[model samples]
Target: MRILTKFMLGLMLVLAVACSRTPTRAPSAGPGANPQLGDSRPHSWTSGSPYGQAVHGIDISRWQGNIDWNRVRGSGISFAFIKSTEGGDHVDPNFRRYWYEAAQARIPRGAYHYYYFCRSGFEQAQWFIRSVPREVGSMPPVIDLEWTNSKTCPRRPSPAEVKREASVFMDIVGRHYGQRPIIYTTVDFYRDNRLGDMRAEFWLRSVADHPRVRYPGQRWAFWQYTGTGIVPGIQGDVDLNAFAGSRSDWVRWLNTRLTR
Candidate 1:
């Protein structure tokens, strides 16, 4: 009788330990679940991957070339950021076509400007405002900041100078569009400029791992996970991004974040 009692106690203890070690299963169709996610050159991420995010998107420039907006929308793309302007005078050749087609396809689209170190922020902001139209139901504009190896403009200003220029640019653009701008940046540029101190939503690029691993505690709204992405409408490899929320959360964000 005593042997039987000891065996039962040991079994119960073992069961308790097993239960403690087992992790609870997350909801299959809840927030952070994305069954439609795909990649052309997928990475083998061990942890902190953005593929689990529910909302996915893409960013495009003239390099993408003659996109079929309808096909892109059908491919589970929730949003898009089209490159509009770069430097002070240069405008993307395909911006107008992409913008119009994307709107016709009913995809939530926004414009982005590539920062030019040679020009003043005010000039760049005005250039962006001239190029991109402010329309209702459009996503907020984006300012992409990154280091360049341009022979014409090899200026890498101090962090203070970069922040000052960014502030000038964001202030002017935000006021003109009636919505705050999103800052898109790489890990090195973000770290060098200490962009975490800035008061704007960030779109971070981290292709190997997750943004958390690269940016480290920095809050981001969008994560660009892969550059060699295969979408239906785009001809060549495209940059793939994911929103940091669920489908419901995306709806809420669009409702509140879109230009009035």
Candidate 2:
């Protein structure tokens, strides 16, 4: 019996190895070119290697400090998500000016709407649409829905209600932006709302580890990796994020979304 069990385990290990696949890779450097993580300049600021290549970006709210675009210019901030409006009545006072500054800095930028569980989907959608203009170079809008029982008028909507309202909001934003919007949520909030049932790409917040444990078998386009990432570009501590796959994946993503 022991011999048979060992044989079975070995076979399973072999099968698992055979079935596994790798993330897609970027093109190799051209004849005279040097890659950022290549020969002359290996990827900086890494101790133990990351699970995937580091493609850094940040998400900001008005609580952050006054940002200097020039200081952040070469800090490798590839993209940003600036908070626009939240819960219908509470708008981020600095959103408009900061968003404009980010755009002026020639950085790719997107906007987000903070979802209110008690509010109507159309109401939130309209607020986001009104706050953000439909510009060609801007990235698609994002819907941020995380639970907070401490909210002044917190009404914990049922999972079904969460899905319905989020869909309506996404559809309205999608029509205006001409692309499907990304959904941002935390592990607990998503599981509580059962947001996995919603058909939108994800930008998940998992500062400790990858979402494999929190959201098993789910796909996320971006991962907010650290709440305390210190980059020279932005003042104060900014939440740092990683693009889901290799550098090649970003090339493909932008090619379809922003053709520059």
Best-fitting candidate, measured by TM-score? Answer: 1
Root-mean-square deviation of each candidate, in angstroms? Answer: 15.8, 15.4
Task: Please provide, for model 1 over 21-131, each residue's C-alpha lDDT reduced to its tens digit, 9 standing for 90 to 100.
Answer: 532443234212334335667788766766667678999999999888878877768789999999999999999988877876767789999998999999999999999
* Highest lDDT scorer: 1
Cα shift from native, residue 48, model 2 (Å): 10
User: Candidate 1 regions off by >4 Å?
Assistant: 1-37
Name the TM-score of candidate 1.
Answer: 0.86
The pairs that clash in candidate 2 are: none
**Considering summed lDDT, which 10 consecutive residues are worst modelled in model 1?**
23-32
Each model's TM-score? 0.86, 0.78
